[model samples]
Target: MPGKKRILVLGSGMVAPPCIEYLTRNPQNEVTVDVASAADLDTHVAAHDLVISLVPYTHHVAVIKKPDGMRWLGLFSTEPASIKNGNIFDTLCHQLAKLLSFKPGERDLVMLQHKFIVEWRDGKKDTITSTLESLGDPEKYSAMALSVGVTCGVATQLLLDGHPALRTPGILAPYKKEICDPIREAVACEGVKLVEKVMK
Candidate 1:
């Protein structure tokens, strides 16, 4: 597809499909999935306009460390020997894939909540909380996979669409209202439930 935005997806785990499906829906996105290892990172990352790391979070830093020019979105985690050696990384990838496989009739759950305390100058304070609970259907995506995948997908779409906060060069997190509001709305549109409340 000429003029399409190329998106490189680094893993083929359960989460990859939802994210890939979401990106491809735009017609302007051309997404490629690779069960990529360290040796393949440079070539694959350099070839795409955006990269989503659905691989084990440990490898995210290595992807980010790749030469500039590509944007990325996904969960991130710690360093490991796999970060340096392609062969070790390949072995670990196989092991991780085995662990992530779901059996028939199996289901998963994900719950995320945050509480914030706000203080006023007059010494009054309020408590605010936001909560999200998602349960996976055995016949479909797991809660972990769907939530992570859809969130990554939404952020990727926003970047491709030239979202102001996302277009800046550097690592970005959804800690700010500007970044979180759009994502929250889009994720809700996908049927994920989010609830917010205030207590004084």
Candidate 2:
């Protein structure tokens, strides 16, 4: 909410080229890209309202694990992997929790907000907003992993499908619906899922 929007961009892959270029051109937004290891993902993701992921589809569900604040996302691909299969990072967390006596339940609690401002023909203005209060179960999904990986998967898929949106070669931002719409549909077919809600 500062004068500039702070966005966390994850990964350094093919799509990172155009996407990062597009975001940096805008002076009002502060964008930082991180090739963070499993150890640092939580710190970076917590600090930004927006995150751009560019990893493989194999990593999304973990990032989406219920954290209180849900982020608006642009994803690239989806590959199915089991949540029960704990990786090295998981074991590390387990060791830390054991040493510190931190109950796993203490980790749940994510909060996210999205706001839309609308203007009418009469010049009246109103704001529409949505909030997500999430309870994270890292076992269900790794919020850190999904937060940084899902968008990359979606972006990756768009690149592969040659979604009608990438009609140009020179540096271009892929946010247009002509591009986003197809990417969403394509990701759905690939067994990827996304959910959004409006609060009362």
Candidate 3:
């Protein structure tokens, strides 16, 4: 496990070949891909340390909640879901559809939230929350599609490089500077401007 990396890619689709190609080029990495359905999720996902879902966005959250053996997942979903929902795909679909249906010239958002609580030596307590929002190009990159795609690619690189900062993973919010800043820069280079704001 120290020298080699295992990556599992779900759903063989138009996006699968390129990601598979990129990972396999590294001799230390082994990539396995499958057309997995919801019924077969836990079994298909249990083997790999790093998982990437190229399936429809609907299946992304389902891949994340399994507390079975795994280190991380690169989920393509644009919305968040609660573990209690049981049917993650259905809940996520309803959220995704609303975002997609926004009219041109209406701002679409990519929001990230980080919640922190601290207890001081004096027994004082503090709760802090930081929120980041990246607004999309209303006319061109409608629904922030360009931003999301580029951010997903950046996340893959972060996982491949073994970035240790996001070691504790469930859903990766990319709210911190390490993840968001690079992604922000990368998307900017593509000429799809992402206007970002932060609040605490």
Q: Single out the weakest 10-residue window by summed lDDT for candidate 1.
A: 68-77
As for lDDT, the candidate ahead, 1 or 2, is: 1
Give the C-alpha miss distance for residue 89 in model 1, angstroms.
Answer: 8.2
Q: In model 2, which runs have C-alpha deviations exceeding 4 angstroms?
A: 1-110, 132-135, 170-172, 184-200
TM-score-superior candidate, 1 or 2 = 1
TM-score of each: 0.70, 0.37, 0.42
Ranking by lDDT: 1, 3, 2
- Tens digits of per-residue lDDT for model 2 on 5-117? 67787876433644555456557667788996879999999997667767533332344444442222212225342333367454433333333332565443445677877
Candidate 2 global lDDT: 0.53
Per-residue lDDT, model 1, residue 74, is 16
lDDT of 1 by residue, 117-197 (tens): 989899989999999989998987888778888889999999999889887789998899999999989999987867999
The predictions' CA RMSDs to the true structure, in order, are 9.9, 16.8, 12.7
